[model samples]
Target: MQFKDQLDFVRQHVKKNRMRIFTTILATTMGCAFLIVLASVAFGLQNSLKKEVLSDDTLTRIEVYNDGNKEIEPTEIKKMKNVNAVTMNTLIQTGNLEANIDAYKGSPEVILTDFKENEKANLKLSKGTYPEKADGVVVGYNVAQILLSKEDEKKLEKEKDASKINIGIQESMIGKKITLNWKNEETKKKVTRTFTIEGVGPKPKKEWEQDGTIRISKEHEEALVQDLKTLYGKKLKAEEMIYRTTAVYATDLEAVTAINKALQDEGYATYTVSQQLEEMNLLFLALKAGLIFVGTIAILIASIGIFNTMTMAVTERTREIGVMKAIGASPKLIQRLFVMESAYIGVIGTVIAVIISYIVSFAANYAIPKILYMATNEKEFLTTEIQFSAIPWQLVVIAAAISIGVAILSGWRPARKATKIDVIQALRQD
Candidate 1:
């Protein structure tokens, strides 16, 4: 039979058995809808987690420490392959440095760090720009918060909110001059210098990003280190130089692992977001697999309904099949007719499922956040958005393909049985 004729024949058969077709389509619609929702939830969670974990500069940067017995020089670390830049971060509170915000006494400890001339790209700023010269300082959000005055703190307490106060402090401290007093810890002699606030950094998300730290030019960093050695009256060895943490920027993300491993091989302890990302991916992979598995159960049950419906259609059309065979219609045409009928049911069912899935996805996204907020008045629900369901175009296409394929497979045995119907016996049936 011609392709158009076969399609018409399938349509007529479906029209004649509308009840049976409706039953099969209903099962398919349920199955396909479940599959879309489950898979979408998995994708949504993965996306949300990626934002929370890999959103920082950790992907392209590595933090190395002096945890190893052998200390590494900033110069030696910079010479390593794939190392684009290296910054020595040294803590200044214990290193004969006293910090104050205008006149605020006993200022919080500040971290003294420097940026390489060629490696400014390694720093991720939130509020202001990086310091270009020695007399400029860039502070973190927490550091800015610490600089809040008693009046500011009292206002925050009175209002029972600190978010605005934090923002005020960060905004106001951007151009203020911060005084740093340097002294020989033993001799009690002090030298005071004031540095202008050049920039503000992002509020600390991870623990390491917390400490109130400031960055200066590499030239000034070296000057401070030399001065510290002089105060101690000894020529400090490269290992003996007081360093807190080192920021190592890779040329690219792919280079992070290699450079980190090389540093580890040299007896340095390294921390990078890459390791956390890998772990998170593995966990999400397993969770998605479980969700898909549960969803497939519904599809499988729907496929069985299709199988049963096709079998009954074959039994009812036995006499018609016999007539077609005797009139020179090929068994291949007979088989194709049954398969096409099943595919039509699958297509219609998938269309309905897609529509319903979209409605549910939208409802869930809009409603879940509101429900959670009602239960807990946390601002994170309002601030940090979480999508419970997100359906990507790729997933929609794949689900359509799978639904049609399953329907065709389910009709296979019934199609084969119809092709094998005996003309003589089927024609003699009452």
Candidate 2:
């Protein structure tokens, strides 16, 4: 028989046994849907975690540490391949530097860094530009809010919530010169320096984080150190000259691994967010595979229904099969017809299952967070962007492949039995 003729025959038989065929298709659909929804959990969590990790600016940053034996220098790190920027900072051990602008005064931590390298590191500023001269500096976002007059300080102390006190230097500090003074504890000597407020750093990433440090050029740091030494009558140690912290920034996320490897080879210890993400991906991969394996069990159980349906189809059509054989139809052709019918069932069921799976995925993503938040009363569930279930195109292909393959296998024995029917016995049946 021709392929179209075979399809017509299968269609007529399926129409005659609509209830049985529908039930069989339903079983396959449930199995496929179960598999997809189960595995989607892993995919959802993995994607959510990746997004959270990538959102951080530090994702492309690598922290470089000295191996104790060798010191890490920003200049040497910058020379390495794939390095976009290298930044180093040294914390002055002296007490907090008291900054003054007119009547307002505030004490803030002092950080010394290379301005040229910091510009390449993509330092975000809320207002003004980076320092061009040694005497120019950048103050943290909180500096303006914290710099207060004596009266403002008294008002803040009287308020129950200090955050409610908004009476600080509200005017812009850009292009204004501020006096920074610190006293040498050992020598009991005081030194003061004037610096122009060139820029204001961006706010901290975390809600609870505060950025109040004053960033100054390395030249000022050297001058301050020399003045402190002259007063204290002691020379600084060699290790003290090394930067307290060094970070290397990559051109992009893809270059982080290469840059980290280069730094490691040079005997510098390095850590990157990408490395943590790689490990997370591996774990999720295994979890997803396990979920898929469990889901395939459901498909295998559904295959039993396909096998029984095909067997009954062959038994009921015995006389029909015998007549076809007598008409010179090949056994292989008979087998192909039965297999095609089972495959048709698989294809139809898979299409329906895919639609159902996506609907379920959408519902889960939409409702789960709200449900969790209501149940736990934790605001994070509602605040954070998370997916409880996700379905990708690749998952659909996998489900289709498994469903169709199992359907074909289930029909093989039944198809073989139909081909072996005795023409005489089948024709003799009343």
Clashing residue pairs, backbone N/CA/C < 3 A, model 1: none
lDDT for each candidate structure: 0.78, 0.86
lDDT of 1 by residue, 1-430 (tens): 7898888888888899899899899999999999999988988887888887776656878888777587867788888888888866666534555667864433555556664432454566776677777788877667765555667756867877665444335345777888877777679866566789878776667544554665655556556666666665556653465447777888899999999899989898888998888888898789877876787788888999999999999999889999999999899988989988889989999999999999999998888887788899865565555678888887788788888889999998999999999999999987
Number of the top-ranking candidate, with lDDT as the measure: 2
Using Cα atoms with residue i matched to residue i, what is each candidate's TM-score against the true structure? Answer: 0.82, 0.84
lDDT of 1 at 106: 37
**lDDT at 287, model 1:** 86
- List the candidate 1 regions with Cα displacement exceeding 4 Å: 92-99, 103-106, 117-119, 122-135, 142-144, 153-157, 164-175, 180-194, 202-211, 216-243, 264-267
Please name the candidate that would achieve the greatest TM-score relative to the true structure: 2
The count of residue-pair clashes in candidate 2 stands at 0
